[model samples]
Target: MSHTDPDRYVTRLFRDDYPILQGLVASGRLRRAAVSLPGWDKATVFEPLVPVSAHGDHHLRLGYADLGAQIYALPSAPYAAVLRASGDYRQPAGIAGLQVCFGAPDLDAATFRAELRASLAQPLKLDSTPHLATADHGGCHATWWPNRTLILESGGDWFLALAFNLETRVIRSPGKSVFGIDLNADPALCIADSAGVARMIGPRHALLDGLRREHLDRPLAPKEVRVVRALGYASGRGPLEVALRDMLSRAEAVGVEKLDTRQLYARFVERSREQAALDWHVSWLPQALYRARIRLHRVDPAFSTQACHRHPSHLGIVRGRMFDCPLCTELQHRDKNAARNIQARTLAVHRHPR
Candidate 1:
């Protein structure tokens, strides 16, 4: 059942599973439909019928086996059918053609061949396991069943996107303390703990630094731009992820300002040129917090920057990055105050969810 070579493994998989698939189709449990190939008009593939929500099982399922690796065998039929329709389903030439169509021009043929071969040997698994219980990353955590597997052809390249059915669960109650986080455009994240301690993580602007170093002299191509952006996002996000996880380990819940993009976009346009990196933080921070297994509250961000944490009703005077509360006669960083307000809002919502 396990073969080292991807081509041989896939070829044997098709040969071994064809009869079982045909039997399922004959029994009306699976249906056959035409899977269009590039030049073929009549290629057929089999797929299981969509079932009701209450159904206990599916024709295709995902399971972990042999050394904790995930496995399944559903997409092979359609994949094989595409190759068969092209007259080279199980042939070495077919795989070569796939490389030509999908592989990068500068990609080493042998390396791409190895990658494809290894990829085919491993198939996507479908299951309804709760994502929160196993939130170490990898796998889609949407609240739906029998997740989809996608084989996309974009920009003359083939891509695989497998969606695993991850069950969404209610966030556990915050136990020890709550941390309020304020993510600002200034490449800094301010955290305020319920115990009245406040701190800031970065003004590093990791994404800006990465991009500047990458595109120092020449303008990059579209593909190069994408690669740069992705790399930048990854580098910038690493520290933030570590910080969030560390905070969650100590706190029962973390509250964040529910930033409205329109407001953020306006602020970015007026005050900064680091707008591109903002997109990554705005979209990813909430999801990351949720997946960290702590109660994540998106508190209203309204007036957080303006209102003084020490005296809520007294609005603060903003002087550059510092805030001066008229009543307290002391100056504090704006982000620290915002973090405190976010923490207070989270506590309010947590106490009265109604």
Candidate 2:
């Protein structure tokens, strides 16, 4: 379903007044536990919440709806007792609180609640938390911690949970942003900025097109030759001459197995020479073309690094290399910069009117 429905979406928030609830249960200090649902005012209790199957283990097995159930059952006991019972199971207590937000357009709340209840009834194992953060700029679902926050476009439909130290209400932030250059496809270079923004550059074809357009009336240079060579290597093709020579060698190799020694040798030699010429042409042609484009356009290499655009001086430093602007205090997005730059340029142009 489309990502525009609120009913298809759910967000759950969990908080606690303590830390390491699981350890407490394991040590036998906490006997039972329960949780409250988002709209509920009370907690449901689980008397003797520790399951028979959870013997000798400490954890909690509460789910989104179970939290509500615990609250609904809370009138029978004190709130603390309910919490103790809910957390009595062998499930890892690492999840101090959980927020379950769903974006399923066809979701049936009753069915979903039932599913949640069933899941909670089973023993729970501690697992890694998925990155899902909501902020004013946009939302992201992190697959891995640190810098790999995949920009999530839910169209408004999604589910998420948060875990943290119960006492402080603070989630341990994954310390650093992970940055890498993804160059396997389309030759685009990507960098995860320090502020959690990713920037990409160099789809060679597009860059080439831009270069050509930008430099339609200029003389090519020797430096341009180097850039073109670099582009050719990036595209996995060195030169036309080299490629032709390689093809000729392959054809001759196939002929050698036919037992026609004289014909094979003649073809092989002819093909080898042709292939060498092709390889030479391939190597130089792209370089020449690239040089011409650059000389004509005066294009500079595009830089893709993580940095806060707000403060361009604050570059992002990773592995002893300066990758992003350090001065920007906030996370900067790659796409946002294009808009920002455009606006800045527009304003400047209007102000100066050159």
Candidate 3:
């Protein structure tokens, strides 16, 4: 079983289908509740289907088990005929600007291209445009056997191709290697290796740190305590801290603002420049710990709030409290979770039999 071999294990593929799912629900073929698989007791599954047009009607599909089988078994002649009749199925004269992943070993580039052309030549109202020229410019990487391919959509767009290599017993990569993370206003930090050191820093921290130093000569206000808290400080509370506490209390009276002390501390920095700096430090601290090679795993935010770590038997118990793990559990912020998941994925790639 080589790392790149696809026959070693069961395979699953997830696709970006929110747009398509919305279309399907609009067309009245599926209900909003049917979007995800329901049997998992351990994790939440969100499978949104993408919209594709065929036979003069818009349809929703995902690049997974059943859908893959349907595409593979689709008769070439009829499929082409349907596409041609649709009038919207014209393939650009050049490369198709699309990314595709194939799960079957029998399928190759030529067959895949043929199938796609057939599908596109139909009189379907495609939700997306066919910009075929962008396809050839992108590179392709694949693992043989069960045969999984991820095609990068070229032309400098945000488009991406992702597929599961079913032959390997590995989970999806959590962070950027699988999906891109956009850090605009939110403070984000990244660590690249097992040593658990900071590799990339966001601008929020630098800005706050500079402000704190500049205000060194001025008397610290009570509000400044919240700012210092953002930096992971434990000194006495400042005026900003008291004001925030009061505001939170008022919000709670109105039936809003349910969060834990740690979360509150984590978000304090977002309140002010001083606080924002602190927020960066608190968020980055976990990454630093991971980079230092500490054997720790971050909590999956998806399950953290909804499920209890100590009582796995109790599922969907959302108590509106900050989720805390047992002493045996690892504490990780967002970036750390991503970094660790990527590392785990890379290790799985190397460990699979070649």
Which candidate gets the maximum TM-score versus the true structure? 1
lDDT by residue (tens digit), candidate 1, 261-339: 5567567522222332343245334444444455778788888999998899989888889999998867998989988
- Model 2 agreement with the true structure over 87-133: per-residue lDDT tens digits: 23323222222213122334343443344345454555543221111
Superposition error at 176 for model 2 (Å): 26
Candidates 2 and 3 compared: the better one by lDDT is 3
Estimated TM-score for each candidate: 0.48, 0.16, 0.20
- lDDT per model vs. reference: 0.46, 0.26, 0.28
Off by over 4 Å in 2: 1-101, 129-354
Task: Residues 169-208, candidate 3: write the lDDT tens digits.
Answer: 1222333121111121233323333333323333343333
lDDT, candidate 2, equals 0.26
The TM-score, computed over Cα atoms with residue i paired to residue i, of candidate 3 is 0.20
RMSD values, in order shown = 15.5, 29.8, 22.3
- Name the lDDT value of residue 154 in candidate 3: 19
**What is the alpha-carbon lDDT for the whole of candidate 1?**
0.46
